[model samples]
Target chain A: MKTLALFVVVITGAMLIYAGHDLPAFGDINSPSYQAPMTQYFINNSLEESGVTNIVTALLASYRGYDTLGETAVIFTAGMAVMLLLRRRER
Target chain B: MSRIQESVIIRTIVRIMVPFIELFALYVIMHGASGPGGGFQGGVIFGAAIILYTMIYGIAEGKKKMSDSLDRILASTGLTIYAATGLICIVCGGMFLQYRAVPLLPDPAEVSKYLIDLVEIGIGITVLAVMISLFFDVSPPESEPEEAEE
Candidate 1:
């Protein structure tokens, strides 16, 4: 059974690596995402729109602020859950 | 943990290093707009400094610095800051989190820059609080509370 499982894992890993060959090269302008107008628009306008030099920050904190808000809530929830589970009761 | 606590050299190094680590975290959060780091990364770093201190000093001393109530309060407060920033945009007659809609400054771009900073700060606070609390919660209580009866 263990040998069969290892065989399955090895085959899957090999297949994944083989499939990864079709992926676009680093920073290829012809990549599907780079070809998209939305990506170009963000690149062109993010600095002007958000006055943030860092594109990632503009994307996270301004363009997609709602998503970040949810992410923050998720972290808070995780902390609360851990506290409830692991914290000792006061004597 | 006890072995480290007993080392004067280790204790002194950690005590000296924590403040600098915290300061660097603040720098990362503030410069998120222009640099590689953002709230999450900075918060994790900040929490790590505390965790390092806790690992050496023990959980009891760690709790004294960041009590359970304080942790809860800070975690909620960070989330509140994020939500409030969005709500304020709505109050300013813009959609939620519409930074340009805020009338804080003459230039909408300028307003966005500042609001983004505010949002980043909110995120940092929440992430920092949560990371510390999670560490405290997950780690075993190696030292018993002083008040515990024998």
Candidate 2:
């Protein structure tokens, strides 16, 4: 069992390291992500479009509001589930 | 916990620090648009404050501070706030979650910004409620009968 676990960990680590090479180098301006039109659009217009200086916040809360809503619902569901599972009934 | 309660200095310091921790959490949530924070981060910090309170004090005392009923209400309220904001936009003849359609504000950008802040606040409330509730549910009061006897 120990050997099997070690083998699995080594294989996963190797796969991740192999895949890491395909990632763009640190802060490469000419990277594909930086060149994407959506990236440029968000960078140039996020402030004027959302009136928020923080690009990430504007993106998450305004541009991608639906996703955040779903996230909030997910947390609410988790809380409800915990309550259902652990709460004691009044006798 | 018994050791923690015995140390007067530790208790005093924690009591003082909890308010500051909570204040910082609020600052993070409110200033998310301008700085590097938002609902989730702030909510976690706020939850941490309560958890700290629970740790230093007892679970019973923590329950007194934030009862189960209050936790559920706050959690539901946050989700309601998020959904209602989106529904209002739909009623205004725009797509769901579209802030530009809301006519309360003049500029589209300004309206979007305001709605984003509201959404952030809702998210923070939900996250904070859920965290505290989860902690309490997982570690319930084990001394109910002992207290009842007393």
Candidate 3:
């Protein structure tokens, strides 16, 4: 157990060192996100589309509401599965 | 605490209060649009009313109101309705749940709003009913399965 923990620490330390070389500086405005893929349209359009004030809520409930519904279904499926398993008789 | 006993005062209060609880649940469901509480929250609260009623009354009474088959219907119907509604958009040339291309009544925009709310209500009903059903299925009165095994 002790050796495994030490090995994990050494591997993590090396990985962190490698990761440090590739990350962008904090809050760089000149990145690709500043101009491309039209993030502004969805951000601006969802409020108008949903007629709701909260942006994330509008995006989640209206603009892309179906995705949220799918996620909710996933939750329901999971809960149902847990119930199904728990209700089974032991062999 | 022990089960609540029958008393004139308690009965009178419960008689008046239960209707209000049910009414409030409907209000939450109907007014989900342009409000914070939507179908999910409303459905949960609505189910809570039934669960509470059973607690106050008895399991037999609860079963009379909410049955096992009803639960299966609620759970299955909700998912089916959700998928079918999304499929409408796919048929209309947009992605799933793409309301813009949903192709609706004379004025599509206004109709879409109403339709979406209707869908939300379906989701609420299914979720709420199934949750209550699951609760009852797992914990039916005093006959806990684990106790029998012991």
lDDT of 1 at B64: 85
Residue range B40-93, candidate 1, lDDT tens digits: 999888888887887787788888888878888888888898899899999999
Tens-place lDDT digits, model 3, residues B1-150: 133525566556766776788788778766666566666777777777776666555566667888767777787787777777778778988877766677576555554566567667777777677667656755545542111110
Winner on DockQ between 1 and 3 is 1
Model 2, position B32, has a per-residue lDDT of 91
Candidate 2 C-alpha lDDT tens digits along B24-101: 999999999999999999998998888778777778888888988899999999889899999999999888998889
Candidate 2's TM-score: 0.91
lDDT of 2 by residue, A3-30 (tens): 9999999999999999999999999998
What DockQ do the predictions score, one after another? 0.85, 0.81, 0.22
Better of 1 and 3 by TM-score: 1
> Which interface RMSD values do the candidates have, in the order shown?
0.7, 0.9, 2.8
TM-score of chain B of 2: 0.91
Off by over 4 Å in 3: A1-44, A51-57, A89-91, B5-8, B106-108, B142-150
